[model samples]
Target: MKKTNYHTHTYRCGHANGNEEDMIQAAIDMGIEELGMCCHVPFPHYRKHLIRSLPSVRGVRSLLSLLKAIIKDGPNMRMPYRDMETHLELLSQYQKSYEDKIKIYKGFEAEGLSVYFDYYQKLLYEHKVDYLILGHHFHKHCISNDYFGKEKMTKKDIYLYCNDVEKALETNLFSYLAHPDLFLIGYNQFDLDVQTVSRRICQKAKDLNIPLEINAGGMRRGLKNINGEQLFLYPNAHFWDIASEVGNDVIIGFDAHDPSDFNDAMYNQMIKFAQDHRLHLIDHFDFLQGDFKKFQSEYDIR
Candidate 1:
């Protein structure tokens, strides 16, 4: 295990326990070499709204009710931009402080292209973000903030999700995808039709050179007292088996939401799984490392 965690979250969004410094310290303890945080974008009730509009998620009204039920932690909960800038500043500092042990990148766990495509295209150029990790939290067809598991997904919704899978790669806005199989819109566990959507998905990823995350967050869900409902990390073991067979740009991340999640127990088995399946890790991504230099030339202000 390389101890490189590319998928991470912080306190500013909602879940996740640590601030940037705490995450870096945990990464150091875990011997993590590269750490990336994919925090949520600000003012996302509308994003979730787009996901709900999809025919895939059932009980849309109830889902909106659930989101509306979100209790304000403090006074500024209503204002997302204020919180976003504060969080971005903290992200920048963490990168500077932990420059030695880990190469930290500015990023966000952005919603699908349906919601943020227009805004994200600008943010990618404007914020100089290093990468964008796909987080399919769509409630109607795939899992939503209100629901988990596959009870709501329909074949059409699955198709819609599959299309988004392609769109995430096509948006030309993200570097890697966090959990590609989170929703499993079109294919079954290992029953993926390579000629169909899976093949296209891999082909596009290869063509565009976008890497997908072999997230270890799913394994953490098995832990007791832990909240795994919406946080992505499950492997969809069979889905990855096929993805590894078809794609070479696969990457791995702990998808850690907190400092305590930096333990070996969280990632050891997944590393073995990725190795067994022959999935490519982010560290091995040649184009990304090289393109990053170019990306830096174009975007890095400092």
Candidate 2:
């Protein structure tokens, strides 16, 4: 039996647990055919690679020596980038070493640039990345300044995330939307017109052949954010239900930050729910691949 956890996270994002290799090993242990490492694409300008998400916590910063070295030597002869390349080559060698066992996709969880488009473009060009997973983890307003506290996301923040997602759709950059309902992660605001807006957003996503996600890590059946109380991410089951109404383009996402959660019962329940509701596999896009139907047959998806 084989499973694929497409929406995954790594330590590079600053909050997620586990390293790259740990996730790979977990996938192997769990019989996953494919594992996608979806990390945050840092905006060099605003976020400085680490997002200052919580209050009293400053984000990761660049070293002045690093800037000087890059400026002096240019891209080819840099110290750490060269070191990083060498290390990455070793990581790739491990993949080659185990090519028969697991297939991996290297990608990033890109923040849909609300105000950091220029910085976003810099990262895309710099990395020339394979594929992207859309995450409005922090809005530009949140990243740009000291708006951090609890994850007290607002429905307006939902609007911001979707709006940025709309931009990612325009760029044709994302393979699938990650935890598309995350804005309600810590909060649930029922007053907003999230369904209408999300429906319109889903329409555009479907038109572009982009996949919307059914996240399993948060509220069960879309009640409210699991942590705080400010906004609704997808608004109960309303948004997922709306996405289901769109037919074969919606996707199921476990949003598995922790590897042990790979075989959690919630994974199957969500798949069964998506199967019953009729959603797409987000990984079907070009950058990576998986077959949810076959997955169910092989892995007891029910």
| lDDT (Cα, tens digit) per residue for candidate 2, span 1-302 | 24666676655444566667777777787777776665555433332323233343344432342343334432211112223344345446656776899887666666665444433343344454456677655554333222211356565666666676677666655677766665544344444466656676778777877777777656344444333642234323556666778753655555666677566576677666676555655445555222223233423422
Put down candidate 1 lDDT per residue, 1-302, tens digits, no spaces: 35576777777655567887887788888787877776665544543443444444347765554345333422111124446667677778777877877787777776564545655555665664666666755533322432323544455555566677776666666677667666652233333442355566666777888887777766766532213332223566556666778765777777777889889876777677778788876563431221233334334343
Looking at model 2, the pairs that clash are 39-109, 184-233, 186-228, 189-231, 189-232, 250-280
Deviation in Å, model 1, residue 233 alpha carbon:
8.7
Question: What is candidate 1's CA lDDT for residue 110?
Answer: 63
- Name the runs in model 1 displaced over 4 angstroms: 44-79, 139-149, 185-195, 223-233, 284-302
User: Could you tell me which 10 consecutive residues in candidate 1 have the lowest summed lDDT?
Assistant: 70-79
For residue 64, give model 2's deviation from the true position in Å.
21
TM-score per model over all chains: 0.75, 0.68
